[model samples]
Target: MTHPDTRRPSSLTAKLAGLACLLTLAPLQANDRLGPINITAAREAPAIAPAMPETVITREEIERSQARSITDLLAGRAGLTVSNEGGPGKLSSVSIWGQSANRTAVFLDGVRIGSVSAGQSYLEHIPLEQIERIEIVRGPRSGQWGADAGGGVIQIFTREGTEDGSHLSGGIGAGSRSQREADAHIGARQGAFDYSLGVAHRETDGFDACENGGPYTPPCYADEPDNDGYQRDSLQLQAGYRFGEGGHVRVHVLAASAEVEYDGPTNNSEIEQRTIGLSASTGRIGFWQLRTRAGRHIDDQDYFRDRHFDSRFDTQRDTLSLANDFFLGPSTTLTLGADQTDDKLSSTTDYVEDARRNRGLFAQINTRLGERLDVQAALRRDFNEQFGTANTGSLDLAYRLDDAWTLTAGHGTSFNVPSFNLLYYPPYCIVPGLCFATANPDLEPERTRTSRAGVTWTRGPWAIEATAFRSSADDLISSPPPSYVPENVSEATIRGAELAAGWTTDKWSARTSLTYLSTESEATGEPLPKQPRWSGRLTVDRQLGAFSLGTTLRGRSGSENDNQGYVVADLRGSYRVAPDWRIEARVDNVFDRDYEVVDGFYQAPRGVFVSLRYGR
Candidate 1:
């Protein structure tokens, strides 16, 4: 049986059509008793399927990987690139399809979380242990998700309650560079009510993030050699109750507070990220099923140097969403949704504008042309208080050629509004002698047009997927050179190809993936900065009774502005002592390769860690 993203169909013909198209998929049930009805986390069926090229990382996989950070797990995955200024908890960014992080949208438990001033989500502060699942949708998505979706979307679902019982789980660990961590989760479900709560704390004394540099040279532009340290405390809660046979209501909250030390004029930062939302879903309203949510997200950050506060930025986003799904015909379903976001910003520096509102209305259709062909289409209209009206659309098609082969193609359009800092932050220098960045009020919104095609083959124990894609970006934004002023720089084209394969069995499992990316500035005919051309990863695992072992190797080629390429490997093992107890250990950067993910910074040399976990 297949468990889809959206609500199940009410008609037998629609159900049959859905079953035919999903025979090759694995099951991911949102709600067992309610039948695939998820109000808060469901984007669409195609976004989670091969139609749009998605990847799902589950809790089980998270535990097996033994990854210290979310970026470590996400990097080297298909169509993704990650950069870090130094070790963990410093400055980090993830790009999709060679685009900037601001072009990608992120959602945590259905709450869109990000910094309005920086125009990107602070994914570093989120506790990795609290995440239950992640859905990565690649390519442009503004036709379905509205602004700030020029690249794609990533949805993170925090741990939820176990059905019909009470459970407790926790773990503690210590690692290299004096790293330490502890986390606990307690959950229960009784009658119609269910809730899960988690809390985590992590701290580390990191290596020197940057080498001492001359005043006129790079590598942080300062002489600081002390060990940098980082700390974070986080909490998450999810609660829900079923009212009627098909009516459910839920609430979720996530909060994190962190302090990060780096090498710069403003060398330390205090950050806070919090989000809360309430959602309700009803099984039937006449011929339709309905879901609605209201939420508030906050990103607050403060910069400090030597215990003195330097600057502050506080932002708030208020959001409301409504979606209705109905059957249009025997093999077709239509989904219509409305969204509204109000963003307000407060900062130490002055801005020309403090707040803006965005409103969007969209409609999507999923239909089967025949027994072997399926199609999805979407159209959206958005109106912004500052940027005015915009329209976007997308189309995706999938055809089943035989029992083991499938062909897919898609086209999408997306747009991103200029950020508050991009539009109006005044020019200033934190270190007196040098200015970092400036803003332009005349900046225009960025737009992207993307096209992709792919093929998939699957059998009993083997699966493979390959795709080629191209994206044309208009009015791209950049901050270059001496002034570092933000502007609509130039139009660009990004082209790439990706392939992934996996094989599984009872005793052994192996998986591998590779990506080739190319980006060019139409004006200068040169490659963009900081984008790697080739990246790939290989993973091998083995099982022997209660003990398991695995190894992962990741490598990426050099690029326009990147240093010489590097290869890194991780070794991990775990032993199940009892039915509910386990011990795990990992050695990161086993080769101790000294390389920089970004210019003027250093990555971790080598590290070892061990953890003890107890759970149900």
Candidate 2:
């Protein structure tokens, strides 16, 4: 089926030039130092130790960068390899330490937020207008989070209303590929209650499609549609209330819907998705703290092939979790938690409908040995009706060498269960009833063991960190011959190193990171496919009175499978047009470098956008 073209036009290059001119005419100012929040610390203590290899992107940085999505915001972090399977709102994935994208966990306000259908998170669905800040913790976190925590975690915190007053803000912008967006936010505080609401709408035309494995020569998919893009709408609301002395409670609700169209070799495909969630939490009672949360997630997909061949799939998940934190002594803290999940799937195909239930319990302890040393240990047991029971654990130690340096080490174990789609996808063949793919009910869960050592230093206005890590996985899942069964011959060993540095002075600030990774299949001794050996980024920001300017350079090395490397540049600036009004603009892909993260997918071309914001 063919759909009408409705994408807006992109103007990224023009806006970028305008911002550069504005910067030359204005004087720049210095940036201020914002104190860091130690996320790894369980409780307040003297001499808070930093979480090594962690990256923080503050509100100021977010505004200065003019990022449209979470993927754009995290593009520069060390040890992260991001790729989009299809352009824009399609499917995007990130790999850390040469691990698969499914190995990483994504959290919103400390709650896991990934789909059970593909075992992947859609970073683009997160509206940037609602974000307060993002915290990235690199390396294994199985002790803290469960399951897919082997590749690290990304936690997103939404904005909370301030106690001082109420405010309203809104903005509109347009960019390349006929992209347009509008966002608004309102926040207020009354008595003991504070609340915030946010909404955003985004639409884009996207780039032309190119057929896979065909000649790169012109006149190929050239006649195909140019600007076949996507649209998304999202809404978020949060409220918190503080009790007189020792209690506080909060509630959050979020909803989003999206529609996308793509060009294929013989036909075009359209996709739509909707998500809704609600959660509540409370705090404080003597030396004990209690928290509970329940949420539901749903996803539906429809694929239109020929008139006679269409497929649809629906997946839903329900989760309930509880946790308690208690102080055992002056030097030790203990945390206990339990979780239960129910997943249901329905498909239009002849595949069997299935329901999977999982229950887990975990405990963690944090202890301080002395003024200069700290240690943490945790254990978890998970029982899934389909896969039986699995156990995981982690141990971490941190030592302070001096006021400016710290040394840290950690070891963790994690696992991944096969998704329903992977185990039940039916086989099909060129012939009417011939078969090509079959299901295997005896598949085993993949297990991984990870270890890392790192060091960090903070001196003057400069901060630097370096880490090295190794991981091995057993019972690794892969697609093998005849019956498409999950085989045990897919084990892999991966090792990598990452380094990052940041410097901030009065009017100027800069940050950069470099990562190198190597992976090999233990069974066949061949390098893993799709992972690049090197990736790095450099960003610089400068502020001048009413005008601010920023630039970024991102680079990726050639992959092990004949993929070429590319470097892209971005420019952004904002001007205070009035006391309550500001104008912002950005240009991305300055050189329009042709690059692809996946084998056949094409990346977006150079784009530009200008926006205006008003607030009280």
Candidate 3:
């Protein structure tokens, strides 16, 4: 790979040197406590004590980090890997705990959001400006949901009205590569009604997305030296009304449209995604709490080799769910739920089957035994039109050693239905050059079982969490040798460990995480692609009067791409000039480390950005 200029500032040393002087500083007391809450770990309750290992990124963290997209916001978490083709507004994929990208399910406000044909969400297009918080469960919870959650679950919460009062906030930013961004948010709570609205726009004249430099070059690079650019616009709205004591009804709608330039026959592509959901919950009736929701989502894509046209694919899904929670006692609860989803796909290419439906029933029981032990058992059965039926279950146990320590363990089973393209791709051939690729119509669902154990310690201003997990899969899907046709042929095993620690005191706060993973196919004994052997991250921040400064460093071992490891650092600073006005600046890729997450594709070099904001 080549670049315009490799020369860059020593950002790594500068960031470290700047933080070295604040080692003994105090914490920012005005900021809320860093322990974020999780809403996706259980089905019966909206909020519960943490019995499973999870990670949460709050709005404050999102704002402080100055993330541009979902991919940037969740780059280096434990037991996870995010691979982008090049830079912003490009294709991106996320693999959790060594599972395939499709095995990880994504949701927005409890509604499943993704493509029926591809079986995954386009994370790069989700604007961060509308996000309130993100909840990531490190392990599977298939019994609570259904298919496509074989690896883990990620739930994104959009901005909601604040209890403090009505407020309006907006920001504008500019950065390297002719990058520009603008966003506005308005939220308020009045009487029994609450509402929030947000809009965002971002664009960038990005670097060359290819590594080969130009069309004449060999190996892997773009066919042209022209810079690939990207643009996106997003809108989000949420409103709710409360009645009775604890009865409430809510509705959420979000839409995003993006156009990105790339180096291929398809010189440019456009994507439009939209989601609308309605949910209602009743107050405690006797001993049961009832909730029901209905949602619809659409994923549409149009590709252009040039200004003319090339192809298009569109997917739509409708989901309905009803759940009830029965409180048996102060220490026991029973949860029952039913879910249904109908998916339809439309594409330029013909498919044998373009639509499918799924129905599921699930139950769970959670109990706290005495003062130390907590147990949860859940079971689910799903019936699909393509594949007959599947049963998945899970067991979770937790023991509190004392006020500062807790031990937990869990075992679960999960499965994924074959995607539309994997099972129904039609045969086609061009005149002079003949070509054919067959799909496996009889493909079976992939199944996995995972067991994990962990311990957590929290005391004073320090917290630590560690977990070890092992997963085995049957009927693994992959392209067979010469034919390169999809097949469920191999058995696989994956093992990993994740550790996270944090400390805060007065004016200083720091957090760090380390992850180790290994994966193998029992048939070939070769390591899985894109699963890094190790990764680590460190972040430290200091508060001084109305000014705050932070530094982040991340390192990861080479997986399938580059043969060596790489490290990147970033520095951020913000100052509040008035009660509702602030200015912030950030420098990313401080060291200008040249590396690649996708094989033969280079990453971004050093870049700087500045922004000004009003209100939050």
Candidate 4:
């Protein structure tokens, strides 16, 4: 299987197509109608919980899904499952309903991020043009996001500013694989202050990410078919200030860097990622309503092959959070939180634990009863200095059963920790390849218990949400091989069902989704590898008058190690070449299917793209 119909355009993809069109209309504060900040479904916003379901990927659906990472704007959204080993910024894996992929949990706007020697969070170097939104919350949030969370939680928001005036925007584009992009932005808000700044660039000319399998498995056994390219650059900054009245102070920064060319044996890799934050809020403090945050996260990696130097992995994370919300009436609300984390690692191979520290204390309550009911509860406790105490909890409810219908239920608990390459990989390995991998200091930590049940329906504009879930995993973690190390006996039973539907008018809009999953292995009952027991999604959009159009469809079924089942389609359009200017186009894999979610890599067959714009 080889594909690469044409290639040219690498003078760094024409210097990233002269980047700057504010990286295709960067949406710093995209007309703020309250988009991001749902805090992955918890902390505040009336404490959240209608059987916990939150997923917002806006930025106008990432420019109507012209996506190129953030794992192509969250693979299949909501019922989450994204896997990539090749194609565009490579090396990715995400699974949330059936868990695994480091048991999910990632954050940016609220600090968290990843890698204390691989506990996840690379989302292929996160940069969908300095992003403007994304918030996902699946299940089990370790009470308030401590440890890995057992599968749920993702938050990313960058680019913010715009409360009043002062703006200058930009954009630029190109496509196919020779794909280049550019961006730039500027923002303002006078009186109390507000700021935004942006820069973005993307480059491509990639294909042939891996193959030549067998003999010892895992990517390249040689036959390097050329063409494995990628490049990225990013920067984002946001500022804030508001005094007296309801006080506020905020600051943000996001940085990204990348380089790629792959097919194993470290054929080239270099990445740098950073997220920093500082936040403050207040509401006269007396009856309480406060928020505080301080954060830092960085993940740097480097590897090279043939051109010399071959290893380095670095990660640093520092965070602090504090919250206090109490609105005893108006439907009730109460929240109290505390969190601190510090994880450190720097390597050139040789890990036996580079560092760790975690502290958590959480409490939550959300209310409203009588008029159709709604409730929420949460509790958490954690302390770790290299894995020690843990306790988590959650409870949720909702009941309306009328004006359409509503019913929900939930329960949660979670844990997962054991990465430092699963307890110290390569602390020492010697002799003719005696260590392709090894580590497992009596590993243990993977405890979860989750439950959910739901129903929601609306009458007008049509809307619906359905959920069913179950999860049980205990001490599950395996490494397998002649000596891959990592072990913890194993036990898992994941179950899932999800459905979503939407419809709108005032220029048409549509959405759909469905999924069902089951992963097992209570001691080899098998079935659990690269998920997908069934999946589906569809999207449609339109907005005539200034013109706009969209289409999307996705399907899946098959996996217990790639059983073969596929479908993919996409199309997008836009035009408004006046008063603010715009023009856009896209078509990716539109019927050019030959799929594999990952099994010898290879994806991306049909493509076409175009872009140009200025100001929203």
Candidate 1 — which residues are off by over 4 angstroms? 1-50, 243-246
Question: lDDT tens digits, residues 93-166, model 3?
Answer: 77789887788998988889987877777688888999998877867789888888878998888999976579
lDDT of 2 at 163: 45
Ranking, lDDT, top scorer first: 3, 1, 4, 2
Q: Tell me the tens digit of each residue's lDDT in model 1 across 554-590.
A: 7676676666566788999999999999999999999
What do the candidate models score in CA lDDT, each in turn?
A: 0.77, 0.67, 0.78, 0.72
**Model 3 CA lDDT for position 571:** 93
Better of 1 and 2 by TM-score: 1
The TM-scores of all predictions, comma-separated, are 0.91, 0.87, 0.92, 0.32
Better of 2 and 3 by TM-score: 3
lDDT of 2 at 436: 48
Clashing pairs in 3: 26-506, 26-507, 26-508, 27-505, 27-506, 27-507, 27-508, 212-221, 215-223
What's the true lDDT of residue 84 in model 1? Answer: 73
Worst 10 residues of 3 by lDDT: 4-13
- Candidate 2 lDDT score at position 139: 72
